[model samples]
Target: VRTVKPELVFEIGFEGINKSSRHKSGIALRFPRILRWRHDKKKEEADTLENLKLLLDPSNLSPDK
Candidate 1:
């Protein structure tokens, strides 16, 4: 595997996300895939950790919500 600098950003699609101790970020994504490269967006515009954590909210996971 080739490792590179975090110079690019991509729009990722995932089935689910949850908190996980196994990961350094304490978050885990389920079946994540690269939806597309976000060429229109700068790397700085990527979603923040706080924003991602919002997905873990119980209210957000409800289908009726």
Candidate 2:
């Protein structure tokens, strides 16, 4: 994750050319400053690989993508 750090994650979009054909992809994220930390939650309860993929599904992301 350090290799991608703060920049590389932005390469992806909820929708668009950036949403490529890879089986698994990483996307850029913003608004983390205003977001809540999951410190109260355990790693098992936090976002997982499957959760990220679920967020990318066409039915999940807003049309603004």
Candidate 3:
């Protein structure tokens, strides 16, 4: 999924998710599902620590606060 900035998400509503990591070594997804249209969400109200962790390796995910 391509990570989008908050400015545009509000214009279209939080309906996007993507990977922008230039980390060529990481395993790329063949398809990423947009779990929800998230019209009720703000940028910070979108996905959370758990949401992002699904796409990351344990070593690379947010291990600490």
Candidate 4:
């Protein structure tokens, strides 16, 4: 049998990492969920690991605190 993959992609911004798991390369998103879908973009055009790391960088966090 053939499996169908999801075509939708989303952009999410969260507070911070709440947990880190030992599963799956020991990397996981914190409180991640569907923020939106980029129907106009192909899967290859989606955000990558580097992008996620950049967003999660400590220097990039808000200065409110």
TM-score per prediction, in order, is 0.76, 0.37, 0.33, 0.49
lDDT of 1 by residue, 1-65 (tens): 34556789989999988777666665678899999998999878898878998789564453323
Q: Which should have the higher TM-score, number 1 or number 3?
A: 1
Q: Candidate 2: misplaced stretches above 4 Å?
A: 1-25, 30-34, 57-65
- Name the TM-score of candidate 4: 0.49
Q: What value does the lDDT take at residue 31 in candidate 3?
A: 49
Query: Which residue segments of model 3 deviate by more than 4 Å?
Result: 1-3, 8-27, 48-51, 54-65
**Using TM-score as the measure, which candidate wins?**
1
lDDT order, best first, reads 1, 4, 3, 2
Q: How close is candidate 1 to the true structure, as a TM-score?
A: 0.76
- 1-65: candidate 2 lDDT, tens digit per residue: 23333311221223322223332345433322323444466544544545555555564354334
Error of 3 at 34 (Å): 2.4
After the best TM-score superposition of candidate 2, give how far the Cα of residue 24 lies from its true spot, in angstroms: 8.6
Clashes (N, CA, C under 3 Å) per candidate: 0, 3, 5, 0
Q: Is candidate 2 or candidate 3 better by lDDT?
A: 3
Q: Which 10 consecutive residues of model 3 have the lowest summed lDDT?
A: 8-17
The 0-to-1 C-alpha lDDT of every candidate, in the order given, reads: 0.77, 0.39, 0.43, 0.55
